[model samples]
Target: MSSVYILEPPTSGKVLLKTTVGDIDVELWAKETPKTCRNFIQLCLEGYYDNTIFHRVVKGFIAQGGDPNGDGTGGESIYGEPFKDEFHQRLRFTRRGLLAMANGGKDDNGSQFFFTLGATPELQDKHTIFGKITGDTIFNMLKLEDGLIRDERPIYPHKIIKTEVLNNPFADIQPRLRQVEVKEKKKKEKKPGVKNFKLLSFGEEAEEDEEESTRVNEKFVGKGKSTHDVLDDPKLSSKTEDVDEENDDVEEVNPEEQLESIRKKLKREHKKPVPTSTTTAEPIDTYESFLEEERREKKKKQFEEIQKEIQNVKKEYHKNKLKKKEEDIIATEKKVQEDKTIQEYKDEFDKYKNKKDALPKKGAGREQFTLNLLEKFKKKIQSMKDGEENEEDNEEEQAWLKHRLCFQDKNPVLAKDANRKDDDWFEIYDPRNALNKRRRGETVEKFKK
Candidate 1:
């Protein structure tokens, strides 16, 4: 049941206009919006749109056309009744492939409209979109944005050389959160003579036109009588004012002076002063911006300080631990080297010693160690002269060893031990004991001699 403005299966009702870069085929949307579409289609059939150019090109945005003067303000029907706004339920200004009406504000729509060079889905639900461009010239126009003008175009020089509204001139424009210039409602009027809201023109053109002897009196068809031969005068149609936006069949704006007067009313309601900071002590905007900058700088400084502190803590912690470890290692090595007796070696050896079995005993196992066990029996070896050799335990042990060796007491006691338990083995306490023990047979022979 919805009245959608879609192109039929070869998908549209239009003739294709080929360009050097691409083709331009427009599918009209009159089916969805009858009046608005009819107006544009009539103008096309009248040869009114021919030789007009894309007066303004915005990169990544739109390329405006339908201006005979190559200046933005020049398009008007033979008489100047701006077309009534067709708020269609079916069509929208949704994307880049759109061909929509362009207005100064509100009902200011004239013969001039714009075409989207690419997809702009973000523009949906807003502007009074009438149709879409159906051909490849969409691409050709896209490249025009980059030619000499990066983002904005010349409203003066680039004009559409020839135009053919080949088929359906009523197309749907994709819509969106549109700018003030593209809005559907009336805007507050500007302070009279404050700024040029009408079509923008160079001051030089006005001077030259005035100097010409022949005055241009070309009157637009539907608009009221006036001397607006050049077409770019930024005026609105008086007939199109205050029409119900929700209704499809509303009257268009005409009667220029009346439209201008109503605009004056709206202007009074919405007028605003020029934008500037209002601060008693200092400019509010400048001070706020300055404070924000200072806060950022403070944060940066704090971050650097924290980073440096973290590095220093890590370095100091590692340095102290390394220093203490080195000192401890040096001290332990010095202690080991300064030890006199090979105490470490002896201690290791004695760890498994069977002390009861290794103690010196008399006769068979004992005295060859030459430790003089008699002295150790009770620590009686007080001096080398009156030592334990003269003690009773020493004399007895020495007698027992001599009986075995068959040596007289006059012979130096090579070794001696206490006459003790039979289970113990004699352990050598003196270095000489080892040599004498090994030379047991020789020692006996020498003693006999």
Candidate 2:
């Protein structure tokens, strides 16, 4: 008998899930799976399950949903990441309507949940059972399951429209709700071409707006003209010609005078560099070279050490493998020697040897019987030896086959040849076969015919 974490049905801690199909009242197992219950309740209070559809549903199995992505890959816990699974011996998916967290692996529980449509013993210890459908609301879960198509998705979107917390056991503890930051939608900016356009109203208002539109169009008329057209205008073209002629009359300066003034200005702006002693410069260069050489030596030493470590590790691994093989061989030999049939044969041979030693040497019939018994013993011993040899041969064949498979796996061409169904045993053994012909210094094309 197992210890029961939940002795009675939970009355206070319950949640009302109003879905598109019908409402489902689930009682939380707060005592058994507190963290899982808390997470579910917090998500409900935050309205995370709202409008989320039951993405997966299977007849006589489960109805899974609560994924904000509407598929199965979204929704996080109240903690913002996957939480640890809370499994109780007593709290299991033994009956229908049990609520459990769906996870990818161990301790990977998220906000996605499932309702067991029937007894699911396989999922007992795997998923964390946090709640169970109470009262007649279990029929609603069945209704959702019934509405599923061949792909396990509902024909119509059976969405969880609202989630209301009817009773909160951890209400005094203050729910640890994740702070969801509402993203503000960016306002679209009007295009530059449409910015100056004004809306025209109808009737008497349209006449007044038309006058305003005329004024606006006139203001933007020059803005629409291209730069090339503006420059080609008669008034602008004449002004540009006058400016060019005026620039041609300006006096030119002597190149030698300009160069002299620039040199004087540069001399005032910059100062001369002071010369350093040769002795100081030489030591600095030598010291830098020495440091570089030391660094190179250190790197070389580290590389050598790493190579040695790798060799040592390889040697250790090989030694362990060889040791394990030797131990296995010894164990098999011991088992063969200690077999009941072999022990029985040994006992019978010992008894016969004692009887032969005690018998009188006069009777020919007694001697013939002893001879026949010895012959039978010899045959039995030979057969045992042959059996052991056969077993050894089988072991060798298995090992060779395993090695061949591994080799084929490494080479795709070999793998394809091994997988070919057309090749028969005779073809493999035949000297006229392509591979055999090639190996025996004959043309493969000649053998193909």
Candidate 3:
């Protein structure tokens, strides 16, 4: 159905694929796959498949070949590009000897093809089936021992010596063979007063020869006569009455007489005419006319002023409109920037909250740490009061006092008064009470020493 041109197969409509094992004749589906058939035949005639091996072979499946690499990896079409798969309902791989294209994926059928060892319905609609093995010899050859079919490679090489076309339809360009040549004769020279003529046909050539011979035999002669010899002179006649009167006494004249007549007429017309008696006319002035002129000037001035006022108004309106549009654009951009910033901040807050919830609670660790610091601080202060500590010890005591004062009574308060508080998990006023309770064992050990 495609408009692409295809080469008609030979009268046999089959190609003989001679292999190492045997020769298998295949009937190419020219009508169904015009482009694919044309490409395959061209490659065959060019000897591209010569010396190529059947790289892929399966015991009970299919045998693939036509790969130039001979490793089941490389092959290409005539166009240097892949061709689309052509599948038809009548060309199903439902039986053995079915020849179909080998492709990497959809519509990527290249030069590689396969022959089904048996019924391979699983391959239907996935590859382009372009031909089919025709004879019983090919079917028998397909059953030959292909050795171990590991990695889909034939252990024994089955090389394709060459493909042969029994009777190619386009073999002879011309029905017959012949050669042709044409030799042009040189033209004869013409005499002084005679014109040369071309010989168009056999009859014209004979007539031209006779005319040439007659002229050669004749002696010197003047130019031949024309039809004007029998007609009256054109200058002696006139088509109109005025023309006839102008030429009533006219006679044939020489070049000198014509020149003299033209000169005399030109001199007579070139003389300047005499000036006539005339007076200059003055513009009539009246009161109504003067008032009209004044009113016209006044209206012209007012029209110019009105034009200027309109221009100014239009300019002001255009400037204001442009300014408003710019302001609106700037405001919209600022609003968008603010929204982006707010979104970033919210994202950061969510990340921090998730991280905090995932971490192990350090409340009990902090309570034990604080109790150790208090014990150390009390010992250092008592040593300093006994004059057994240095200046550094005094400084350390001051830092401890600062820490204690900063943390004093800083715990969160409850909704009820402290007087209502009790030593229970719910009634405890301190936020760290849970940490201390968990570390009660450690606290008792420390106080015992």
Locate the minimum summed-lDDT window of 10 residues in model 1: 1-10
Model 2, global lDDT: 0.79
Q: lDDT of each model, Cα atoms only?
A: 0.61, 0.79, 0.73
Query: RMSD of candidate 2 to the true fold?
Result: 38.0
lDDT value, residue 104 of candidate 2: 93
- Please write out the lDDT profile of model 2 over residues 1-449, one tens digit for every residue: 12332553454489999997789999988988888988899888888899999889888999899899998989888776888988776676667888899999998988999999988888867899888888899887788866437688777768899999998888654555558799999999987763322353345676667677677678668576444443446544322334544446667899999999999988977766667766643455778899999999999999999999999999999999999999999999889877867898888789779967978677897789789879865764575555532343344235535421111235445334655666563333786677786788876565578
For all predicted structures, in order, the TM-scores are: 0.32, 0.40, 0.35
Over the stretch 1-449, how does candidate 3's per-residue lDDT look in tens digits? Answer: 12111232222346788888888888887777766776777777777788998888887788888899988789888767998888766666666776788999998877898888887878888988777777676755575435666677767768888998653434422222225477899899986884444534466777777777667446324555333432357754434345444547777789998999999998887875668768776676798799999999999999999999999999999999999999999999999999999998998789778966865567986677778879877876677566565456554346536532222456788685556656652643554565775665434446568
At residue 278, candidate 2 shows an lDDT of 69
lDDT of 3 at 285: 70
- The alpha-carbon lDDT assigned to residue 319 of candidate 2 equals 100
Predicted candidate 1 versus true structure: per-residue lDDT over 411-433, tens digit per residue:
55555347653556665556467
**Between 1 and 2, whose TM-score is larger?**
2
Candidate 1: regions farther than 4 A off: 1-22, 118-126, 155-158, 168-449
Best-matching candidate per lDDT? 2
